[model samples]
Structure formats: C-alpha cells, structure tokens
Target chain A: MTALKAIDKTTINIEKIRADFPILSRKVNGKPLIYFDNGATAQKPQQVIDRIDHYYSYENANIHRGVHTLSRDITIGYENARAAIQKHLNAANPCEIIFTKGTTDAINLVASSFSKRFISKGDEIIVSVMEHHSNILPWQQVCEEKEAVLKVIPINDAGELVLDEYNKLLNEKTKIIAIAHVSNTLGTINPIKEIISAAHARNIPVLVDGAQAVPHLKVDVQELDCDFYCFSGHKVFGPTGIGVLYGKEKWLNQIPPYQVGGGTIKTVSFEKTEYADIPLKFEAGTPDIAGTLGLATAIDYINEIGLDAITTYEHELLVYATEKLQKLQGVKILGTAKEKAGVLSFIVEGIHPFDIGTILDQMGIAVRTGHHCTQPLVAYYRVPGTVRVSFAFYNTFEEINVFIKGLEKAIIMLK
Target chain B: MTIEETEQEIIDEFELFDDWMQKYEHLIELGKSLPIIDTKYKTDDKLIKGCQAQVWLHSELKDGKVIYTADSDAIITKGMVALMVRVLSNHTPDEIINAKLDFIDKIGLKQHLSPTRSNGLVSMIKQMKMDALAYKVKRE
Candidate 1:
C-alpha cells in the first residue's frame, strides 16, 4: 500500500513522459485529448517517429537481396532490429524471430504451418473462451480444413480461464494450445506459464499471444518456455505493419514455411526450390524495413524507461481507476480477475456502451466501447459490449480523474 | 412537410443549442419519442447491424409514399434513427430518392453517424432509399 502511494504520477515526472508523445498535447472536439484506447494501439512516441523519418530520409533501400551498398546497409539495420527484438524477448537466437504484419499474421503463420506439420483429423487445438478473433479464427480455419477439433477452455465469471477445463481438454488428441497471455477485454493475465508447462508435459507445443502482454509486461520467451510468442509493434508504441513471432529453434526449423517468395528462397529451380533458414523462411516478399527500424527504436525507448517502472506506475493507475469507477452506482465493472492489467471495462445500468463512448468522445476522452474483438467472452457477460479504458505508462492520475468525470457526464447525457 | 423543409426545421432546432450537451439532449429526446416498431417486424432481416449497436428498421409504402419506422438498442443512435425517419418518411419515391439532407453536418453530429462508424443510420438511409426504389419500380 505504501509502495502504491510511492509510485504516484509525480514519481516519474508524468508531464515529462507525456511530452514524448506529441499527440498527447493536442485537443479533440475542442477539448484537451485524453486517449484511453491504448489497448487498441498505443500512440507513437517522438523518438519512434524520428527514427522512422531517419530511416526513410537516409536509409531507404530494399533489404536481403540487392548487391548495392544501400541494400547491404539497410539489411544490417533490419536484421539488427530482429536482434534487438530477440534480446528484448530473451530468445535464444535471432533465427527465432520472424517479422510479420502483426499478431494476427503471426498467429496465422503458426496455425497454418504448425497444423500442416502436426495436426490431423480428430487432433484438438485448445483455445480459451477469452481469445480474440485473431487467435480463434486461424485455429478454426485449420480445424475446418483438417477435420481437427477445436477444444475451447472455458472461463469462470471472474474472466479467468478454467484450468480444470483446460487440463481435461489436453489429451493424446491435443496438438497445440494457442492462447492470449492476457485477455484484451477482461484485462486478466492468464496463468500462461502454468498453461505452457502443462502442454509441454504432454509434448504438445503452445503459442502465446503476447500482443496484450508485451506492452504491459516484460516478456521473456525463453523463461516462458512458450513454443511460439507473438506481439504487434503498434501495441508497444512502434509503427504499424510490423510485428515479431518468436519460435523455439526446433519448432521453427521443423515446420515448413507458411509463405514463400523472394526472401524465403535460397535457390529456385522451378522444379524444386530450396528455402532459406528459420526467420527468412516465413517472411515472404519485401518486409516493412522502416517499420522494423521504428519498432527497434520503440523497443529501445521502453527499455530506457524500463518495464519495471512502467508496470508499477500502470498498476497504481489501474487501482486508482477501479476504485473511482466502483464509487458510482449503476456502473458495473467487468473482468474482476484478482490479477489484471491496466484495463477497466464496465457497463452502466440501462445505458448502451456506444452511447457512453459517443458522449465520452464529445468530452474529448477516447475509450473503446464494443466487444473488443472478443465477442464470445463479452457476450458471456450478457451485454452488447463494454466501455473500456486501457492505460499506458504515460497516462496520469489527472487523466483518470478527468475520465471519471467524463463518465459521470456521459451517464447523465445518455440517461 | 417536404424533405428539404424538414431538414431546415431540424437544423434550426439544433441551431438554438450553444453546446454539444444541449444538442445531445435534443437527440435523446427525439430518440425517446421514436415510435416502437411492431414486434412482428423486428426480425433479423429487418436488422441493420452497426459495428457498435443494432438498428431494426421497418418501412412500408402507402399512398405512393414510404412510411418509415425504426428502433435502436442505443438511445443516441435511436435519436439519429428518429431523425432519419422524420426527414424522409411519408415522401414520394422520387422525393425520397432525390432528397439531399445536409442537416446532419449542420448539426455537427456527422461523426456519430459516419459510414466508417457503422452507426446504422447511414445504412438506414441507404435502406430507406432502396425501399423507395422498390416501391417506385413496383408502381412503374
């Protein structure tokens, strides 16, 4: 409790941190902007923006193919980003990192490639009720194609995954378990370490959806021992169109390439083409070179501030927000997991979340109001959707107060 | 009233409000008064699924004109649905088809009912126009 008070917004000089994000200073709907939609995608910092500009300004070139100096130099920069991401995730090798469009693309790659190698008719892919559409759809696709069963891990009312159900679902028929490290809508941090170890015990591979987790927590893929870990660049204040998929060397090498093209080939004979090694094998066509550099810069930006500080600060904000939200009547909070990240989802009695979101927008505070791409889970709560306010480290106590006031205003307007 | 005149009237009513709160209050008031569609007509086929909310629209042509009725799960969106119903309902097919209701931008709630937001009103407008076109074709 003392530590919570100690980690106040003043501790980090919140204004100084807020200054790094240029858009934070701007107004929306004639009022100062209070962006609480970080769960959708985080706003980029100036450092990441400048790094992107610096890339295109002086370092624009095709990577991994050209014989020219610009091409060679840019290739180094791109691969160096891979190395940085590898180090950040504490992966064993750079080869373990494959750049994709984002988490969706990364999961699709694994679902397609891994299923092709391991899955068969009647084999089960274990997912939870709390999966985002990205995590679910791909596995659904694989199951539909191969006649494999998609076994769902149910959740309790608290939005935490039912481990008993998950354990029961894992058997000789189970091929893999793909799940989010944290629930997007509920903010519940799933016991993925336990989930992974359980699967590993059965010799089944597990893919961790770190899209939500990476921004909030410092992820160590090696420590997690997850077979595959995927996260989006934009979620962690990096550029869009770039993401990382970290797979163990054995799994990466075992599976065939999900996609194959220019960079994916070592030599093409039209008769039988030889594929490139681990990372390149999955990357087809020209990748987002500028985005990769920008992502590395973003990684550097977070590492400089340190995840430990961000985690503590964001936790304090979460507690502060939850307490404030609870003080009001007719406002019911969803996702009351004992262990949650800085996401607050709630529905006010007799008022639609969309109306609340619209009213909040007028007050210049941005919040997401919908199922948040986790339809089944949200529907399980028996509401159309929820108004969600997710946080980043740069978010402040003052911002939360403004948001609580705005919510009060919204409730009055909608009512 | 003619569609254009109805639009101007709506605009003038919105113009009296100095701030967003009053405008939204008027909208909520409008929504509260939206006549409920018959439960028999509130089928999935009649549903206009917005990304954020759902709207069920029922339209029937009488006396060579379209009579529009709609409902929404959200109150503010219902207000917008009410607006759409008020402006274009009870118009002849050609009048409904050719109407250019610019009152939306004038009231400054355009973003709330934007096509990108999938607020159902845009699609409802399209649906109204299509209903008019169907009646027009049937008459011809």
Candidate 2:
C-alpha cells in the first residue's frame, strides 16, 4: 500500500463550504447525503443558485438583437460572461470563447465544423481509448460521413493512456487528434500538454475534452496551446445548457458553423445571407441567457475562492478517501495513475457495481455506478463497471469516514 | 407546476412512503396503469438494452401526441414508469416537447434504479418523443 501523502495545504473550510449547498444538508434514507458523484454534475453553491434566481428575476431578456433597456442589460450580462470565461480559461482573447449547450455540444460543434472543411475521404482522426462517448462519437460521425479512418490510442493496465502507443498512432495522415484532458472513467489525468505538443509536431490539430479537468485544476488554454479546449459549466457549479469552447482564431475561422439559425446570420437576403464573426457565428439562436449570466457568476465565485485552494483541498479528500476505501476487504481500486484529480473508481469483489451503488444509496451515500459515458474504457478493463466516488473541494474527511463505514455495511450485507 | 400544487398533491396519496416493505406493491400498482404493450411484439428487437431491469417499450401517435406502451421485468422499474407516466401521460405534444424531465434529481428514484435502468427510462422517453416527432413530420 502506498502511504497516503499529506495533502498539499489548502485554505477553504470544508464544513463552511458544505453549508453553501442546500442539498448537502438534507438526509436521504434516514442518513445524511454523502454525495460522491462530482464526476456527473456537482452540487451548486448558494451563490450559483442565487445567481440563477437573480437572473430570472431581474435580468431576463433575449440578448444581442434588442435595443431596449432590459435587452441591453441582459446582453451585457451575457457578454460579460464570455469575458469572464475568457479570463477563467486564460485564453488569448475573449473572441476565442464561444458558448454552447455543454461539453457534448462544444465537441459536436468542432466535429461538425472542422470535419466539414478539413476531413476528406482518406484522412484519419486519432482518439484515445479512454475518451467519453461525447468525445468519441462526434469524430466518429465525421469519419463515417467523409470515409476517414478513426484510430484509437490504447491505455495501460493502470488505466493511464499509454503515451508510447499514442505516439505510435500519430503519423502523416492523421488530420486531427482528440482526447480527454482527464479520463472521467479512470480519473487518469493525461499528459495533455505533451500530447498537444506531439500532435502539433505532426501538424495535426488537437481538441481536448476538459469536462473533468477544468473543475479541478487551473487551465490556461494559451499555455497548453491545444487548438481546441472544451468544458461544461454545470460540472463547475454553473448552470446546465451553458458551456464554453475555446478555439484558436485561425481554426475557428476556417471551420463552418455547426448549426444555422436566426442569430448566426449577419445580412439576410433572399438569395444568400452572410454569417457573423467567430463567437456569434456559432451561437445560432436565442441562447440560454439566464444560464450564461449564472455561469458567469459561478466563474466569478470560483475565481474569488481561487483554483489553487480548490485543487489542494480536493487532493487531500482524494488521498483520504483512497487510503480508507483501499483498506477494506474485497475492494480493488481502479486507475492508479501517478497523477489524478480526486476520482476513486473501484469494484468490490463478488458484487456488481449496480448492487454496490444501490446499497450505498440506501445508506445515503450517492455514487455513480456504470460505464460513465466511457463504455469502451470500462470494457477495455474487462469489468462491467466500477462504483465511482469522485470528490469535489466541498467534500470532507468526516463524510469520507461515514462512507467507509457504510461501504463496510454494504459489503457485509451483500456477502 | 407551481409550488402550491406540488405541496398539495405530493402528500395526498397514502403516506409519502408508508412502509418500506410495501413499496414494491405501490410500484406494481403503478406498473398496472402503463398502456398495454402488444406481447406479439415482444422480442430482443424491442428490449431496452442498457437498463438493469428489463424494459420493453412501444409507441403510437394519437392525435398529434405520442402515446407510449411500456413494461418492465422489475417491479420497482414499473413504478418508475408509472411516475414518468404521471408526469408525462396526458400532456400535449407541445408540453412534452417543452419539458426536460430532470430524471436524476426529481422522483428521488435514481437511488432505486441502476444507471442502466436510468438509461432504459431515458430510452423510453426518447422513443416516445421520436414518435411525436414522426407525427409532426407526417402532419407537415
């Protein structure tokens, strides 16, 4: 057993932070809710909740088109969100950031646009074996449509991406290489900076699905130099239906719009209408206005609190959780990558992941159990699915203690 | 639905959850209300694959709205379908189109259903929506 290292120092108080989420205080099945499903949408803070409410109450109006006072206020709120995200991601320009529905929509936008322009009959797109379905499926659709080959980079036994294999897969014909910044299934934080650099050498554009990474770490899109970076707002305590896609200006200009609708056009004529610029060119219609406002508020909240503090706090929780969860009999931890972000995927011997999740739920311990949108990765490990306990900064060691005891009881009951 | 309506109707039924032992019985009763599924159509072709509980769903368009006939091998899952039907059954095509049906948070039921069962429920909802879409396209 690797000794659990003392966590990198953190400033935020977990109990104080936990109080901010109303749902965290509630009881489930007579026991307090021990939410461990941060991988699938996290519990929002009071600030985020209030921000959404405030938007609807005070600032509800369609943006971009209206000249009215309410419309201008709403439009400013929406664009301010874009600017906030531009800073949050540390992008080179605010114009580089375009809002979409979520991680899926962002990835699809790139696939639809870039593939329409660049992908041809015999080109290839390389994706890691550990990608979420959202990351894999869009590229797949493009390949199927254009008669391009879709190649996969396999993973090591520990569920980490085999960098050697990824290097081997890259070659002349690979037009695009897309991979997840962090494996949601295994919790393996890939060496994406290196991955991006390697693909760039081959002159292949890279898109990173940062749905898991952005929530846990500070991400600088320019520093990474990845051509495309995408993440969901909901995963980072923001509203659903709002997400950001950071694309290099050069690439975004070359790709066509993913959807054609009311807002995307510039000048409408009977014969042919011109399109708008980079950000507006992609956003098709009356967008999630309130959601964008709320998301911007969320970004502000996260920034004020600081990502360094959040990262250190979650790392401690992960170490504490991993050590305790590993100590129990019949427990086998998956994804022992040297670097990870607070996710503990494990399967109990002689118990199904579904059964484990159900039993834990009865004890008021919430966890995600199943393929987690990464069916290929779960299948690659030769298991049905593992019960995933992903921690956020708000979670505490006391909660982890209760979880360990509840897990013991569950295992005993199943036995 | 308004907060008042939710509060008023939420507790109108026999206790919110009376006895844990009798929970499955309530589920069975809920299952009984599901529109009739044609057994003749029972085959792997109609089976929802991702659910832990076996669910079989079939759909038909009735006067612009999609009517669904669904059944599940698991009793609890049948209750889940019943809950879905309560929220969804008589609603108009437009109403169905508008609702997102936050499956995880609402119903306090994902705890009862496996991820696969949840996925199956999702599939049933999607197929019903598709049936509506087909009806819309045909009308157009």
User: Highest lDDT: which candidate?
Assistant: 1
Top DockQ model: 1
Tens-digit lDDT track of model 2 for A1-415: 2334555444686677788899999999888899899999888889989988988887788899889999998888888989999998999888899999999999999998998889999999999889999999999999999999999998888888888888998888899989999889888888999999999998889999999998899999989999999999999988888998999999998999989888898998989989999889999989988778778888887777788888777777887788898899989999998888868999888666765676677778999987788888888887878899998887888889989988887676555
Consecutive 10-residue window with the lowest summed lDDT within model 1 chain A: A1-10
For every prediction, compared with the true complex, DockQ reads: 0.84, 0.06
Q: Which structure among the candidates has the greatest TM-score?
A: 1
Clashing residue pairs found in predicted model 2:
B51-B116
RMSD of 2: 9.2
**Deviating ranges (above 4 Å) for candidate 1:** A1-11
